[model samples]
Target: MKRIPKSLLKKLENRKEIGTFRTLKTKTALVDFSSNDYLGLARLDAISVRAKQILTDLGHSANGSTGSRLLTGHHPLFKKVEQQIATYHEAETALVFNSGYDANIGLFSALPQRNDLVFYDAFVHASIRDGLRLSRAKSYSFRHNDFEDLARKIEKLTSASSVWVVTEAVFSMDGDSPDWKSLAAICNRFEVHLIIDEAHATGVLTQLTEIYKQTTIENHLTARVVTFGKALGCHGAAVLGNASLRDYLINFAGSFIYTTALPPAALATIAAAYEKLQDKIGLESLHQNIDIFNRSVVNLDLKQHFILSQSAVHCCIAPGNEHVKMLSMQFEKSGFDVRPILSPTVAARKERLRFCLHAFNTENEIESALKLLATLL
Candidate 1:
């Protein structure tokens, strides 16, 4: 075997200094304040049973996508789900990808040409950064959610090249959202292509259709990317755009072309999940839970400790890596599956405990968790 290099070891050492090392774990039997299953679809027996029925009905008993989507892997479920998603989100078309990461990589690496310029929020997700890194376009970051700074940067870039403006609908860590209408207006004024990654927003927002209708600054927008892994509690993602963008991606987007299609079961699950979203009563219950969680935070006086948010995800700042980890352990001991967002994942000094709110979380559990948090902080 070839010897392991010491330089790679040094990189690991650097991560430790900043208190940002990654680890995996087994499932914990706790009241979840840290899962992305906001609507409880991931755990629903009905969804699973329906997915199985879908598979049996379609006679797609295969365990794998036999080839890339361009070849034999493009199943009928893909078309059905794509059209359903497009109609749900009120877009001209929708293209499904294997996952959120793949969708972001495919879009960023392929859409931006060498002469194009990309401007993104400084605090956008790592997947966006990775995608940008793979592109030939000149890219720069604006201050996080600072539209004025973004406008200035865009103005400068637009004079030299076509501009692509990007940001998340809701920031994953900060638990806040960019002003979509205002930002989209700015993109319109500059005649730039606007793109939003709705990975964290799709199932959480009641006004998603209104937001989508308003998110477009003009006709220049290439697309919006929405993922199911987070709020939808399923496993795949879709890029929503016009017919041309879909066709172009089919031909380009190396990540889309080079990877195997998602399993037929997964696609069926995604479809059924969307169908369930039409149940107004359930979505309302999820919103009520979010309200209850926020109220609990206020009652415990932990509001000041938390980042302001209306989404299912809430965050409480703990400052240092050691501090966040310690607090997270306390929650774990008390039977909550809260996660610690360490530095490098976020920035230094911004380490936090992230609580992912879910519809099924009882009022008692929500209050107890906040009470525990108050004691810890």
Candidate 2:
């Protein structure tokens, strides 16, 4: 076998020196504060039962989707689940992808032409940035969640046949959201096509309602990338838009064209998870935990150390990578699963302890975790 090149080894050495060396760890029984199962649907027995029922009903006994969707892998469940997702999200159609990364890569790389311009939020997920890099369109990023800066940048664009703007509904790391209304107004005024990644916000923001119905900007959005892996605790993603956009992606997106489809069981699980989103108890409990977390931060006077967010993800800044990693270890010792966000995942001196709250996390757990964090700080 060939050994790794010296340049790659040097990069690994740099990561170690900077305290950002990466390693995979097995899941522990520590009190959950790290996983993306925000609604706790991944462990829900009812979802498993329904998913099994779905597979049985479809007579899908296959272990894998033997080919890509364009070939033999386009299972019957795909149409059923895609329609369900479209209806739930209030879109004309939905195109399922293997994952959120696939959806972003497909949409951004295939949709935007050479004469187009894309302006994205500075802090969007790396997937979006990578997609933009593959696109023929010119792309630039504005300050994080700053619509005014976005407008200024757009105004400075000399010549572009079309304009597109991108942002996330709930930023994964910061757990904060942009001003949707303001962003919509800008897009509307400028006739800019808008794309929003709703990976973290999918089930959390609108458990009982469609996301389109919750905001006035629904009609203004050109596309919405939603993932089932986060709050839904499923294993796929979808791009929701008009029928034409879905058709275009099917015909042109390389990622979707080349990759094998998700297995029948994964699709069934995603469908079951969508149905589980209608349960008010989980949504209510998750929101309540978020509220408890906020209040505890305020009571402990730790609000200043954390980012202001209404989402299930709350980040408490701890600066240097070494410092933040140490704090995470402290939390682990206290039987919590909080993790550190290191650079260049984030900027230098902007590393943090990322706390992901979940529906199953009790008020006692919330309070205790915050108290421990406060003491450690």
Candidate 3:
């Protein structure tokens, strides 16, 4: 009964005043345009059925992972799935974590010891930043996707005992990518290790995000983090690297060491998703939708308002939080499911409507949404 803490109340008041207060809501019947299910696998009943089949065939019927992997939860399926992940992604070994957040937190917190220097992109995912915050290493942020800025920072401290470079393959909010080859070359020149989160580019398992599409970036880079929540339409994330790195995480990464392991269904779902990735059924349809959406944006003359991106995420700057939320309401009324990314999630002026493209989205749907958006603008 202590008046609910004045400081906490003040922060809540400030959020409401700025239109940044958040609330949970149930799913809607509006057209799909805001989910991370880029490949539409989440809607495929076959995947769910297959997941169950994989689990049963493996002779496991447990609903929970019993305990932490290092203790009692390290199931036999973990080894099998990890091997498949390594072969599919061409990594020497792979370590699966409960989620992307856990993977990054464990990797960053454990790998970079005290006195090491860490440089991350300005727009890198929050998970990586949080991990660095929990580490003892000295860290700096370079300009977003700017190799020159990163180079300057590296030059200032090239003599550090160890240096790590962190970035994302496809930025979650902006939907743009950095030049991996360029970043790799710079890291190599400065004797630094490179880490990339491929959360937004999962599913297809292509080299599309890399400048050299024909070859794998695993050897040119140090580590890669891939997740299933986005394009793969599943759960769980894995850090792909060499065998020694996996050993290191198993031995030292606290997040990996002290956490309860993912259940068998999650691992089975992961295996099923990768199988679908290999068959390439959903990839083509998803890529087609992305192409259609990209073309429709240009054709509708909404290019000026949109962020330049080749990924499934498209952002249209709407300036004010109030204005953006109003625009989102308009979109919902028009049968589109676009959502407003208000301040504090992104910077204040960067508030905008985010449209998430999916393979299930039709060309007409894409064009119609853009046409309506054009008229509103």
* lDDT value, residue 298 of candidate 2: 98
TM-score of 3: 0.95
Clashing pairs for model 3 are none
Candidate 2 lDDT over 277-312, as tens digits, reads: 755538988998899999999999999999998999
RMSD of each: 1.7, 1.4, 1.9
Q: Where in model 2 is the C-alpha error above 4 Å?
A: 207-215
Residues 1-377, candidate 1: write the lDDT tens digits. Answer: 98679998888888777667666798889888888888888888788888888889987657887889999899888988899999988889999998899999999988888999999999898888999999999899999999999988877655546788899888888878987777877877888887888898877775866765667653656788999998778899999999999999899998899999998888989988887776642567778888998898888788888888988889999999999999999999989999999887888888899988888888898888889989888
Off by over 4 Å in 1: 1-3, 13-18, 214-220
Listed per model in order, the count of residue pairs whose N, CA or C atoms clash below 3 Å is: 0, 0, 0
Off by over 4 Å in 3: 1-4, 208-217
Angstrom error of the Cα, residue 90, model 1: value is 1.2
Whole-model alpha-carbon lDDT for candidate 2: 0.90
Give each model's whole-structure lDDT. Answer: 0.85, 0.90, 0.86
lDDT of the structure predicted as candidate 3: 0.86
Question: What is the C-alpha lDDT profile of model 3 across 123-218, one tens digit per residue?
Answer: 888899999998999999999999999998889886678888898888888888887667766765786787888899876437643443333344
